[model samples]
Target: MEQYKKDFIDFMVSSNALKFGSFTLKSGRQSPFFMNAGSYITGSQLEQLGIYYAHAIHDNFGDDYDVLFGPAYKGIPLSVATSIAYSKLFNKEIKYSADRKEEKDHGADKGSLLGYSIKDGDRVVIIEDVTTSGKSIEETYPKIKAQETTPGGIKIVGEIVSLNRMEKSADSDKSALDSITEKYGFPARAIVSMKDVIEYLYKPDGSGLITNDIKKQMDDYYAQWGAIM
Candidate 1:
């Protein structure tokens, strides 16, 4: 793994965003662990989170993307923070755009989009926390593509999430990220994987250590719900 990715795993644990325990997912499967990006609410945590995202974005998607599009709610802050980091890290300008649950009828920028306008020919990359079932993309992509400012429409170059659970979606055999890429014609990348999480916690390192029992639990969980891709 890259240094930033390793550091991000530690950051997730320290922020309590990634937890190892029995949990039930919205898909109705029992998960051995869960990652909630909402735990990163502090100043330093968000700063580091943005840095990790920026690095991963640069690595996977390069610096050519014109905008960062985050979904509503959690993705709003993620888009803003990563855009700031991208500007600072690469010294290149990047716009941040996010979706709104409903169009604002009384606001100045009264549209479904909350930030930078999606102009035609704009290349966008999505920043998300985690993608297990790809529900967000299914809900938001059409709305985003429909609002393109030009005839050619905006192009979504790729998407990056904090973690790839490496589990199949509810309706597919491939992993959620893979399914999204296959269906949408763009690549999906993550800062780390559940495999990385398990390896980091199982072995000795500076972040933290996991017990042997927990290691087994993680393995067992993967056996039940994991996807190879």
Candidate 2:
């Protein structure tokens, strides 16, 4: 793993964002591990989170993209913070945009989007905390595609999430990220995978966050719901 990924794993654990044990996901799966991006609450934590995201985005997508389109709610802050970090770290001023659940009826900035308005010919990269079922992308992808005033519309170069669960979706044998890629025709990637987490935290000497019992539980969980990827 890269140093940033290793650092991100440490950061997630230190921030209590990534937890191991019994947890029920929104999809109703009994998961051995869970990651909650909302745990990074402080200003410093968010700044660091943005930096990590910037690194992953730059690594995966490079500096070709013009805008970062984060979906509503959770993605709003993600887009904003990472744009700032990208500007600071790479010296590139990337615009950030996000959709609103309810469109504003009567304002200069009315309609669905906030921050930099996604325009025609703008190359966009979707940023999210994590995608478990690939449902949020379904909700926001059309909203983005609709923003194109020109013929070709906007180009979605790729998507970047914090982690890849590496588990199959409820409806498919492929992982959620994989499903998104196949459906949207853009690459969906993560800073780290569950495999990376295991390799990093589980050691032969029995140290690290993942213990023998926890590893066994994770193994069973994967056996039941692991993705084809």
Among these predictions, the greatest lDDT belongs to 2
lDDT of 2 by residue, 47-80 (tens): 9999999999999989999999989888988899
lDDT scores in order: 0.87, 0.92
Model 1, 111-227: lDDT tens digits are 778988787889999889998898889887887788776754788889999999999887887899999999999999899988887777785443456777777787788788888
**Candidate 2: TM-score?**
0.98
RMSD of each: 2.0, 0.9
Summing lDDT over every window of 10 consecutive residues in candidate 2, give the lowest-scoring window: 203-212
Q: Which stretches of candidate 1 lie over 4 Å from their true place?
A: 149-152, 204-208
- Deviation in angstroms for 218 in model 1? 1.3
Error of 2 at 89 (Å): 0.9
